[model samples]
Target chain A: MNEQEAAALFGALSNDDRLRVIRALVRAGPDGLAAGEIAEAIGASPSRASFHLSTLSEAGFVHAERQARSLRYRVDFDRIGALMRFLLEECCAGHPDLRSCCGS
Target chain B: MNEQEAAALFGALSNDDRLRVIRALVRAGPDGLAAGEIAEAIGASPSRASFHLSTLSEAGFVHAERQARSLRYRVDFDRIGALMRFLLEECCAGHPDLRSCCGS
Candidate 1:
């Protein structure tokens, strides 16, 4: 990803609630979780969860699918992978110390 | 790194200028660069670079050391490693796809 994209992705992750939401989705795995289920899991109101999920979706960190009555949110592993690569390779310049942390 | 710390670190990285400063510092390596040098390298004004550097320093991504007449800024590899680990392990929950991106 380019620096601008990286900055925007980081901006999406700059909130505590969003981070919590991402973690919740990660735990939910590929099947994902409905909006209300995510809200209950993260202790956020449905509206607050929806707001953060929308921000994450716009940033390409998460994807939503209409299942029955609500949207099911899932973490986008490929996008997240690209983000980590950008941080480790571009930002860190593949520093050996930082690379080792990634088990590279 | 907890969710709050990760959010704060991502917040520090949310700016384009700050991202440029970080990439410049990574290129500069362990010897680091003074504020004036970093400003020039990133094409930012001295004051602008100083402001972003202060934010990065406060967030523990970079640390400043008094070196003669100026403060030399360097990326904290350990802290950065921790942040990456937080994203890959904690946020991603050690997902195989994400782990592979980290070369784990």
Candidate 2:
């Protein structure tokens, strides 16, 4: 993603419920979790959880699939990695000398 | 930063000008920048830049120093690093197998 896209993605992450919901999906792995499961994990009202998940999906941070009547959400690692790298290249104050600044 | 603190910091980064201003300060290293220099670096109007910098400073992403009429801004790498690590630990969907998810 470019700078503008990164900004938009970060803007989406600015919310507490959204950030919690995304992180919960990240922990759930590629298989993901259904809407109810997400709400349980994040301890939010189902309506609130669904709302946050929608925001994450719209930002391209997560992918949702219909399994039965439930919507399952999975982490979009590609976009997450892209964001990490973009921040490293464009926003990291991380110094090469410090080596602590960049790379995992 | 805790969850709430991380949320707040990310909230500050949600804006384009503020993100640009913070990133510029990150690239500037510990010495930071005067208000005018920051404006020039980001191609923002002085007044606009000052406004953005104030936002950053208030968010604790930057620290300002006054030298005569000029105010210098520095990246609070501690906070930047904190935000990164928090995102990794709290938000990374990364697996140990996919070490790419965290650290850097």
Candidate 3:
């Protein structure tokens, strides 16, 4: 990704609530979690959770799918992987010290 | 690291100029770069580069060392590795999809 895209992604992740939402969804895995479940997981009010989830969705960090009535949100592993690759390869320039962290 | 610390680090990276500064430093390697050199590399004015550099330094993404008259800045590989580990293990919960990005 380019600098602007990467910065935007990081901007989406710059909030504590969003980071908590991401971790909660990652724990929920591919089956994902409903909004209420995610709210409970993050100890956030439904409205707060929804706001963060929307930001993550907009940033392509989370995917939302309609599950009958409620929308289920899942972490986007491929997008996150792309972000890691950008940091490790593009930002870090594939430096050995940083690469070792990825077990590369 | 916890959510707050991770968020703070991401916040430091949530700007194009800072990201550019980081990539340039990565390219420069451990020898690092002086404020003037970094400003030139990123096409930012000295004052603007200094502002972003200060933010980065405060966030522990980069280290600044006094070298005679100029302060040389370098990316902190260990801290960055810790961040990657946090994302992979804590945030992503060691999920296979995310782990594969790290080649682990």
Candidate 4:
């Protein structure tokens, strides 16, 4: 993941509402949840949920799939891991003595 | 780190200038860089660098210490690691089949 990608991902997760949406989808498991279910779980209006989902999907933090008549959203775990690695690389590079920073 | 902390950290990193400041500080090592150096490295004005540094410091993403007449800023690696863990925990909880998502 490059700095630009990490920056975009962070921007996507910055809002409270969006963070809640991501959490809701995450708790919904790999099968994911429909748009309405995500709205219900996050107590967001359908329009707001749709907006957040679109932002997340655009940032590559989450993926959306057509499921019957509804859309299912799930966290993109691989992309997220790459983001984690990008940040950890900086940490270790900045502090060699703290090379164990990401070991745990 | 909880959702709130993670959210605040992400919010701090959402800006392009702030992200550049972080990259500069990371490359500067633990001793960090003075505010002017950060501004120069990122091509930000003094006031702008100060604003970004204050936001990052407030969010606990960076730490600042007085160095003579200047202040040195360094990334808080532990806080960053905790934020990564919080996000990873959600991924694993959301998808048991992806337990290795964070292993790499």
Candidate 5:
């Protein structure tokens, strides 16, 4: 990803509530969690949770699917992985020893 | 890193100037670059670069050290790697195929 895309992804994750939402979804695993569960887990209002989730989704950090009536959200692993790779893309260039900085 | 630490680090990276500064420093590699060079490379004033550099350093994304008169700055790869790991800690919690989310 380019700097602007990475910046946008980081911008989506720079909030406490959004981070909490991501962690909760990560813990929830493949089944994911409904909006109310996420709101309750993160101690955020329903509307606030919805807003943050939408931001995360728009940034490709989270995926939302309609399950029955409520929408379920799950962390978008591939997108997140791409983000991690973007952050460490060059990773000290060809200095193999410097791989520690790239997280090995 | 914990949620707060990760949040702070992401907060530091959320700005465009800081992101450019990081890309410049990453390209500079081990020798690093003086504050003035970073400022020029990123099209930022010395003071502005210094402020963002300080923020990145405080968040453990960059390291600064004095060499002669000017301080040189470099990306702290290990710290950055740790941050990446923190973001992908669970990685689908044992679903091997889901490893894609962790940036495999």
Candidate 6:
């Protein structure tokens, strides 16, 4: 991904609450989770969860879909992989010798 | 990595200049590049590179080794992996169907 988008993704992750929210989503997995469920999992108020989810959606790290009235949020692996690749490209300064360890 | 360190790493990456600095370092590889060299590569002033490098090292995303007078910077893959994993765990919030795409 381009640097600007990368910055947005990073910015979305930079906050403590948001990171926790994403981690909760990761644990919740392919099923993803509803807004209230995620907030409760991360110990956030409903409003706070909504705010962080908006940030994640804006950054393209997570996608939100409305299931009934509840919003189901899921991780966006494409963007996650893009980030991993961007940071790990030559990764650790070309420890190309160590690339075997990276794919895990 | 724990959430706190993850937050710092994300914060360091949130800026555009720092991301460029890292991309340059990633490109430069295990040889990593000297401070002056990295600055020139990313079109930043030497001092700016120094500040940015300090943030990266502090956040544990990059490492700096002194080669006589100049310090060389390299990506820290372990931390990068940690961040990627932290975000990708059940990843995309549980799309086991998509596991194939993640390890790449």
What are the models' TM-scores? 0.96, 0.86, 0.95, 0.86, 0.87, 0.81
TM-score of the second chain, each candidate in turn, equals: 0.93, 0.80, 0.93, 0.85, 0.88, 0.83
- Please provide, for model 2 over A1-104, each residue's C-alpha lDDT reduced to its tens digit, 9 standing for 90 to 100: 56577888888788877777877777777789999999998899999988888888888888889999999989876676667666665666344432263335
- For each candidate, report its DockQ versus the true two-chain complex: 0.80, 0.50, 0.77, 0.49, 0.50, 0.47
lDDT of 3 by residue, A9-91 (tens): 98898898888888888877779999999999889999999999999999999999999989999999888888888888888
What TM-score between 0 and 1 does chain B of candidate 6 receive? 0.83
5 against 6, candidate with superior DockQ: 5
Highest DockQ model number:
1
RMSD of each: 1.1, 2.5, 1.2, 2.6, 2.5, 3.0
The candidate, 1 or 3, that scores higher on TM-score is 1
Write candidate 4's Cα lDDT for B1-104 as tens digits: 66666777788887878878877877887699999999999898999999999998998878988999999888877776666666666424534333354443
Candidate 3: Cα lDDT at A13: 87
- Tens digit of per-residue lDDT, candidate 1, span A1-104: 78888999999999989988888888887799999999999898889988988999999989989998988888888888888888888888888999887666
Worst 10 contiguous positions by lDDT, candidate 5 chain B? B90-99
Two-chain complex of model 5, DockQ on C-alpha atoms against the true structure: 0.50
Docking class of 5: medium
lDDT, each prediction: 0.88, 0.74, 0.88, 0.75, 0.77, 0.74
> Residue B9 in candidate 4 has what lDDT?
78
Model 6 lDDT per residue over B1-104, tens place:
66767777788888888888877776776798899998898788989988988998888878888899988888776676667665555224434433345444
Error of 2 at A61 (Å): 1.3
Q: Native-vs-model 3 lDDT?
A: 0.88
Error of 1 at B58 (Å): 0.6
> Model 4 chain B: which ten-residue window has the lowest total lDDT?
B90-99
